[model samples]
Target: MRGPWSSIQSKLVFLIAGISMVTVLVGFSLVTERFAQSLRDSLENDSLSLAQRLVVDSAAYLSLGMAGQARDNLLDKVVLNSPHSLALFDEQGGLFAEIERGGGQIVVDDYRPESAVIWESDWLHIYQPVEDSLDQRIGTLYLKISLSQLSHRMRAFVGVLLVLLLVMLALAYFLARLMQRYISGPILTLADISRQVRDHQNYSLRAPVKSSDEIGVLSQTFNDMLETIEQQQAFRDKVEQSLRIKEERLERAVAELQYMANYDSLTGLPNRALCMDRIELAIRHASRTRTYAGIIYLDLDHFKDVNDSLGHAVGDELLKATAERLSDVLREEDTLARIGGDEFVIITTDFSSSDQIIPLVSKVVERFEQNFTVGRYSVQSTVSLGVCVYPDDGDSVDALMKAADAAMYKAKDVGRNTYAFFEAEMNRMAVWRQQLGSELQHAIDRDELYLVFQPKVALESGQISGAEVLLRWEHPEFGSVSPADFIPVAEHTGLIYRIGLWVLEQACEAVSRWRDVGLEGVTVAVNLSAAQFRQADLVEHIAAILARHNVPPQTLELEITESMLVRDVDQAIRMLKRIKLLGLRVAIDDFGTGFSSLSYLRKFPLDALKIDRSFIMDLGKNRDDTAIALAIISMASSLRLKVVAEGVETPAQWSFLAGHLCDEVQGFLISPGLRESEFISFYKSFSLDEVIASRNV
Candidate 1:
């Protein structure tokens, strides 16, 4: 029973029953809304003076015309004395008279002529017109009225204002129980003597001072705070046992500085920032138990050849005996970690199936193929691993540790004592090559990349000389995404050196717009990527995009691939002799598909080779692709080099590459790429008049 604000005598009976029911419901709702607006303005002036005495008693029944016999003697005296529904219209608004009381339908153009009263929701209406003896109106008188007897006089004046708001809230709850004995009986006797001095920690009970008011000075300051808490209870139990032994030695020095800040003092494990915070709490516990959460990554394969042939204290005791033999084969809710030098990772969580992550990564690659003595150095290791899992291969903890370090470099490329699984086609090409390297690093500032060109035809002078500059994209939600699907996702995300300097300033402004449309010496090309030819600002951004598009440098060619000139054949012969001392023209592109060695391709600086469309896609039925496109046009006519075959398509592979003097040729036989105003309107009026009219037929 203690709840109207729980007790000081039910908070003085709910503060005198909420100020006597909000002052008797706001003085009975402002005296019943001003006595229901003075009984609706005295029932609209007594139904507009009983519709102006039924329009002056039907103006003597409309001057003896017998107004329907005075509306059947005033419709039974308006249904026994005006409770309302009376009607009589005339001046052409028809219903000359009516009373049949059931309610609502009283239209005679709802009688207006300066309406006297009209209310509605359950009738009020009252109009009156008639006149005659020198006034001259004729007929009209309405009276509706059924607001059910003023809604039974405002429901008996809201039942006498809800019985005077419950007799002023039962006389303000008996004057708040007679003012709770001068306010809740001395604050409930100082709240039952401070709840028996707080449930009997009895500080020698007191609170009896009866009436010096302010509850006798709050019972004399609660008996002087129980005489200073029984005179400081044995010095607060010896300073609360020395603050519980200094909060258990400050919680054991903050759990040893949170385990030396998330572990790994020489491989005590849990480290790469506490294994990426336990691989983001096992990827939110494998997304709430739909279960599966692997991660492994390991990597100690040739632990940097035993940390460079055993030294740093036997490579820190071989990464602490390989993190205690991979935490003795994991699952006490797995985690393992190290994450430094010889990497480590592990993680796991509620597996059950994904073929139980290849027998738990073949028991940690058979515990790193056995040998591990460390102090007296007994090494031999082998661990690659990689795995990945949860939500296929990555639902983030840095995309499942970068899809378990790209499946541990595809388990050291399928060799090093393995364990791979991060596949769903390499996690959908590493999440669509990280969403096309974050949309090709804003695809050349959202133009979603472009450039199409593709021409290179010469074929022993059947014309349209050069084109290539490919790089396409489109993508507004994955549409035409293919430079063979985003140029290896922009060369594994270096965003191919800003998409190879925006395709070398858009292929040198399309070879200075094919030399301002005369289409002179056309060469366009472009390609690039061994991370954009190891960019030491690729020969000063291709000689400042061929002098910012004024073009020259032999109308710009570049291309690159023989696996980017054998990685570093002396920095590809000093960046191909500074791009052939910027007179520019280097090709090699997909030529004989890469492992170039005419002794570093005749020591670098030479030019054209092209060839590779898998040797022009089975050139005239493959006699080993016509002896590798006739030994790449007889080794680019004996190294003075200039071949260019690439996907020639037909006319017998362009008449067997122009009978083998193949100096130039590109795909879809000579056109297929186009858009720079359709390769300058097909090299201005059909490239040498359509290859000299298709080679004179």
Candidate 2:
């Protein structure tokens, strides 16, 4: 039973059927008990009434003196019509009368019954007393009704009720089964659907709807919920897919941006920004390990020649090839970066000493010295490399780069195609250069810098054609420092702009002074360093200074070295043109020492070309120097530029340059640089004729 009822329908059917069975049993029992009670009451009432009637009639006859006949008649009537046995007794409590008929018997005895019997096996007894008119007892009357027929009727009625109860129970069972199917079936199906949805993720399934009841409405709502859930799940999947694709795209974009930030686009090597970062990291690592690192700053020797001859495309390919070669030569731990157009940096990590770097530097130089074939253009290139080591050259990245750059320039000074390690003297010179730079800034501020005029004498007549206004620093601490020591420092520190301005002011002042002293038509040439020439405001500054000083622009000549013109020819030419537009003279100072061609010489605006002091110093000792000096004079004369020879220490050197048809000469041979007052006194005492006579002797 328990197993069969485990099903929801079976359980519900059993529960409802059991309750209906109990209700039917209780109702039938209550009705049967009440019906039996009513039948017993009716039978007793009818029997008593008949007995009393007989007693009354018999008493009336005795009172009227017809006792025997009336009694006989009454007995006969009661006996024939009554459904009971009848008996009568006199007042003596003795047997008197009895009636028995229709297969029933009645007997009278000399005893009175103690109790009345309503139903018995043979009869149901009813008793009554006979009374006179004065209500005196006369005789006793008794009747025994047969209860067999009533027993049959009661049995039939009980049988009928039992059958009806059985029929009601059967009908209740059928109705209970129908109700269970109608109510529990849809609920059980919904429960199964809910469990399946939970376990299998089957949101597409709907509960079965059976009828238009509460259960049916719940099933419809559950199906609507499943539909909503399916729609939401689909939307979530689409959103997840879109997010994944967007995330992948964002990741790729970030990677590309990172590459762009750290690498050179064309060469595919690390750029300056990345190089500096690596240098900083290497410095920290070296400091921790108590080791040294090396940096090699390399600039291609004739890259400009390639770029000018070949197109930029071939140039770019050549640079790429160079990068690849350098990377191949370097160790895995080392780093190489392309810092500029033709500049590259190689960082060597964990180096033990300076000697450890020499081999690497040599390999790089030798490799570049070979020919490179870049798309049908065979090119031979050399690199000037400068090496700076950790803790020896510099401790910081900026210091290291500066030291390496200075060493690279030193290598170029010794001739290209070589490498130079930073020396102790170079570091010392760096410090001194810094100190000089500081003092030069102070000197400009405090008005300690002054210009001294060194007269430039005409080679033919020894007459002062012009004077070179040379800068001198009378430092408060160092007293007097040479321009050879501090001029480069000023140029390197970018203090040349201020110092150059001061020089122009002083030169203009001196020109005014010379005019006040009646010295007319004498030009004062002021030397301009490369850094000063590159100043964007240089021409404007000079024009402003000249105009303010009330000095003729022609009398104030700005002198620049050939190296300055060779560095950036186009920009230098443009600057020179601007300066010439200001009505100022531009001359090439220290000529024949840099890579200046005849074409450049002819193209540049110039008033005079001064032979470099190195050639003047070796005038009589080296034939090459003598020839170089002669060639420079001839070239300047051909170009219609006045030729001036500087650094003449001996009279013989001056005579040589004068005989070579040099226009002007300035050096210690004439007079050492002097103060303004002393120079004025010397000029007053000395004559051009006397100086020429002494030179001829």
Candidate 3:
């Protein structure tokens, strides 16, 4: 039966089935969505219209100024027409009329005076005000209709689809059966013989050939294969024995190769690749556990003189001895890797505080103060150590490595025999951020939080195109704090939600003031932190802010990083679309720095892609950076999005981006972030040529 289905003949069946399935799926999706939408629209519209008509129809009866009981009785006109449960309430919310299918709690979010629709499970609940000729509210009309009809129709449609699918499948099966020929019987027989021969190890067996077609050729080939197998059986056993021996040797070689790949050949310590993997794993674990992971980067001072004077052999011995000594000091879980010559890194697997790692750093630094003996040669090698803590200094393995390396160089810079925390300054920063997090609650109250506006220049016109809102903290002790210092702290402490809202309100306030004084068409971009962006109430909050300030949404643009979309693409898309619908422009900031997909880029309702400053900073000077900037511009163009180059400080950067037709450029070259008054002054007195010649604002 499968003879036709098992060969080229089955192609037609598959093609027909696939086409039918795809056509049905596509048609069903389109029709079902449209049908559901129509049903919803019809339900809401009809409910509202009916409620309004009933309100008007009963208004004449209720206007007679009869007793409350008489008005209640008069509202029966409403129940007569309404198929589902309803209640007519007077202006004071007194129940005038009532009808119900099943006893259900009369629930509405709030007593909305205006008309609104609420989807209550399978019921469409619509409420509207009963207005007289003078448009005064006489009463409120509430009506609900069952959505059961929609479900029924959808089920019926799905049933029809199922029947259609079954019919197509049956037709395919029938066609396959009709196409199957007696020729398949011989081929099946040959298959059975071959299977049996293989199962029983009876290679002497042969397939019988009955025709002179392909099947005949297959049968003859099968016979020849069996004969050849039988003759080669002994030789195969001998070959298998040889292969087993070789396999054993290969396994040992593979193990050795694996060891050599990951471990330093001389020191037997984990090499650069394995060290990176270990550090990355530790970083990930620390992030999840909310603890600190540390890297202790050690470099021997003047060890190159040991290499040149004492020779490579001594250096190798010294490295191995150093590795052994370091391994002895560290716990089993900690990694001591010889990533380079005279440069070693010890990764703290897990630590609750930076203090735990500092002891290890000190021990390593102190250990190197002693003399290292290698092959009858004594050498005094003082090691400079740099320590970096996770999350505070950096989050990633590469970042932590670089941070630790920089600290090590710093230690070397300050005379050799000492250790330095790369984030030593960061320790103070951490304190400041922590202080800000706790004190941010009072920032709004103390009137310390203020915003600076950074102007973005349109490359084409060389005039102010937009301004990004930069928040500053003016703590009593600290005169002015950069957003870079406090933003992350706020995010971590969950104060960003409040700070973000404040920022939005402030931005809207600024925009409102500007518009009042005839500074219209200026879009103020405000950055949305990840935590704030993910809030369910962000859209409503923003709408309320815009309304409160009497500022149009078009005047305010929300700048979101690509990371937000990367976390939850679908949710981000929905949120961004909501913002788009609200008439606010959205731009993906630091575009090239994130792992956002190209597919997602189009899905995002984005107005612009702001190329990361790092890429823009070296444009024209660095070929790769220039290429990346150009590529981003081209992609944004192809996607029908505007491209804004950020951190454009140099004339060369400005010119290169202008040449590429970048939509806007923002950086110190245009102007550093300014006070609102200063920005307004600059905005009034600035142009492309003016700023370039003056060097800065």
Q: Name the top lDDT candidate.
A: 2
Taken over the whole model, the C-alpha lDDT of each candidate is 0.77, 0.80, 0.79
Candidate structures ordered by lDDT, highest first: 2, 3, 1
Model with the higher lDDT, candidate 1 or 3: 3
Candidate 2 on 386-422: residue-level lDDT in tens? 9999978889999898888767766765888999998
For 531-645, candidate 3 gives per-residue lDDT tens digits of 6776778999999999998998888889988866765566678889899999999999998988987898978899999999889777887999888899999999999999998
Error of 3 at 629 (Å): 0.1
- Flag the better candidate by lDDT, 1 or 2: 2
Whole-structure CA lDDT of model 3: 0.79
lDDT of 1 at 186: 75
Candidate 3: segments with Cα more than 4 A from true spot:
1-430
Tens digits of per-residue lDDT, candidate 1, 556-674, equal: 77887886666446667887898888788888888887688676788988678888888788887878877977987787788888888877766677777787688777777556898
User: Which candidate wins on TM-score?
Assistant: 2
Residue 240 Cα positional deviation in candidate 1, in Å, after optimal superposition: 14
